[model samples]
Target: MQPLILHIPHASTHIPFKDGYLVGEELLQQEINKLTDWYTDDLFDSPEDITIKADFSRIFCDVERFVDDQQEVMAQYGMGMLYTHTDAGQRMREVNPTLRKQIKEEYYLPHHQKLEVAVKKQLDQFGHALMVDCHSFTDIPFERDLNKKVPRPDINIGTDPFHTSQTLQDLTLEFFTSRGFSVGLNWPYSGTMVPMAYYQKNRQVQSILIEVNRKLYLDAVTCTRNRHFNEIKSVLNQYLHLIRSNVNDIFYPINNES
Candidate 1:
C-alpha cells in the first residue's frame, strides 16, 4: 500500500515579501494570527506519511485557492489564490497584474508543482494516491465565511464528488464520530485539494479535507497550543495509521467472483 500524502497548505506564518501588502506589520500579524492554520504541520504529522506543506503564509499566497480568480468563489471576497483583501473586507494588498504574476511564480506555482510531483510519484509506484488535505479552522466564523452559524462542530470533513468515494466518506465519518468528535460534512468549509492535472480526470487520485476546529487544541485568543494539543496530535497519528492499514479496502476493494 502507498503511504498517505498530507497536503498542509496554510500552516506557515512566513511573509516572503511585503511589496504589495498595504497593511502594517502589526495589522498583518493580526490577520496572520487569525488566518494561519496554527500548528497544523505538527498537528497532522505522521512518521510514514508524505507531507507537502506550503512554506509561505497564506497571507502571502494561498496554495489552496484556484489559480484563476474567475473559477474561485472566494475571489469575490478578495481572498483568492493571492488575497488582496482581509477577512473584514479591508484592502490589505495592491495586487497589480505584474505583482500577481510575480507572486504566482515565486510562491503559488512551486507549491503546486511539489504537490503534483508527489502525487505522480505515488501513482507511478502504487497505481493510486490518497491525499489528506490537512487544515484547522477557527471556531468563530470569519466575516467572509459562507457559513456564519454559531456553534460549529469539532471536526469537519470536506469531500470531492469525483475524488472522494462513498466508502471513504463513510469511513471518515465513522473514524471521527467513534472517537466522540462532533463531525460535520462540509459545514463551514467544503471541497478537497487535487492537483489540476488529475482533478476530475483521475479516479486513482483520491483526496479528502480534514478541518479540525481550533478550539479543540488551540488557545484562540493567544494563538497558542492548548493543553489538548498533544492529545489531538495523537488522535491524528492514529487516523493516519487507520488510513494506511485500510488503504486496499478503501481504494481497491477486492470483489469475490460469485
Candidate 2:
C-alpha cells in the first residue's frame, strides 16, 4: 500500500461549551451545521488510508487557517485561526489575544501536529505523502463570503504550485469532470494545506484540496445526506483506488519504477 493521508478538517460539530462561553447551544448547533463540510469525512474516508480529522467545529478553532493573520487570506474577514465573526458577519464570540493563544495551543497546534506526525511517518515509509484535504461547501454563498455573488462549481480543486503539479491537477480534474461534475480549479475557495514546519521546504508532500458542492449529496435545509450520497461515495471510493494504484507515478515520480 502507498502512503496516503486523508485530511478531514471541518466535518466536526462538537463545541466545548462547558466554560459558558457561547451564547446559545441551539444557535451554535445551527451555525456549525451551516459551516461544516457536512458528511465529507464519510465521503472521502478510505479503510486503507490514514485519516486525521478535527474533533471540534471551525467556529471554535479553524485548524486549516495559517496561524499568522498576515499570511491567512481569510483573516481579513475575521475567520482566521480563531473566528471572531459568524457566516453572516455577526460576532460569533469574543476571543481576545490571550484566549486565542489558549485555543491555538490547545486545539490548533495539536491538530496540525497530528497531521505532521502522520505525514512524517508516511515520508519515512514511502519517501512521500499525498494529503487529500476533503471538504464540502454549500451551493449558495454565505452572507459574509467575499465571493458571495459568484456561482460555485460542483467540485472546486484547491492547489499549491509548490506541492500540486500539473499532472496531478489534470488527472484530478479529469476524474471528477468525467464523472459529470462541473469542476473548477479554484472558484469559491483556493489553496491547499501543508504542515507549518514543511510549508515551503518539502516538495515530497503533495497536497490537494477538494470541495464538493453540498447540493450533490445533501439536503441543504435539513443538512442531511440525500439519495445522491451513496453514488458520490462510490465515486470517491473509485478515485481512492485509482490513487493507490498510481501513487508512485502521480505523486512520487522519482520513485516510479523504470
Candidate 3:
C-alpha cells in the first residue's frame, strides 16, 4: 500500500558515545538496547522485554574516525570539513575510502533517499504526502550536567522555519498542544541537512524533519527506559493521527474552509 506519511529516523553512524575507550554513546545504547534489542529480530519489538547484549565495540563509537587505539594515526584521505576527520582539513588517511563512501551510500543516503522516492511515488497515487524525520537527543547540557535530567518539551514542531505554511505550522502546534503535550518551537533543534525537493512549493506533498529530545524517555547516564517512555509513545501515536487528518488542509486552503 502507498504511504501518505513517511518517517526517516536518520541512520545512526554506529558511533557509541564514550569517554576515552568507550564514548558517551555506550551509555545511550544501554537505553535503546532495552527497547530495540540491539538490532536483533525485528527492527524494534516489545516481546516480553527480553534479554540483550552489550559488548564493547568502537565501531559504533564514531562515524568518520581518523585515529586508532594507542594513537595510531590514519593517513589522510576525503573532502572538506564536513566529511573529513575530526581534525579540520585533514583527510582520514589509510582509512578505507571505499568503506566510508559505502557507509554513506549504503547506510545514510539510501535510507533517506528511499523514503523520498517512496513519498514521491505515493504522491502520484495520493494527492498529498508528508515526511517527518524522527530523531532524539539528550537534553542534558553539553558541559556534563549529571544533575537536572528533567525531561524537556513534550513536543517540538518545525515547519521548515516558516518556509512551509505558517497556517499549517500554527495548526500543527495547536494539534499537539491540544493533546496535552508541552510544545517547543525550534528549541534544542531546528533542522539539519533536510534536502529540499526541486518542486517543494509546487508539489502536493510536504516533508519536515522533526527531532525529539531523547531524554524524554531515557535516563541521561544509563540510557535505560525512563518512567515516561510509554506515556510519550502514546502521545506520538495520537500525533500521527492528527497530522494525517489535517494534512490536506495545508495544501488546499479552500479545502480547509470546506
Highest TM-score: give the candidate number.
Answer: 1
TM-score on alpha carbons, each prediction: 0.97, 0.93, 0.59
lDDT of model 1 at position 111: 90
lDDT of 1: 0.91
**Ranking according to TM-score, highest score first:** 1, 2, 3
lDDT of model 2 at residue 12? 88
Choose 1 or 2, whichever is better by lDDT.
1
Better of 1 and 2 by TM-score: 1
94 Cα displacement, candidate 1 (Å): 0.2
**Candidate 3 structure quality by residue, lDDT tens digits, 106-199:** 4445444555566566567775555554545455432222233345675556556423555567777887778776766765555422334523
The top-ranked prediction according to lDDT is: 1
lDDT of 1 by residue, 100-214 (tens): 8998987899999999999999999988899999999988999999998779999999999888877788889999999999998988899999999999988888899999999
List CA RMSD, all candidates.
Answer: 2.0, 2.3, 9.3
Cα shift from native, residue 250, model 3 (Å):
1.9
* Better candidate by lDDT, 1 or 3: 1
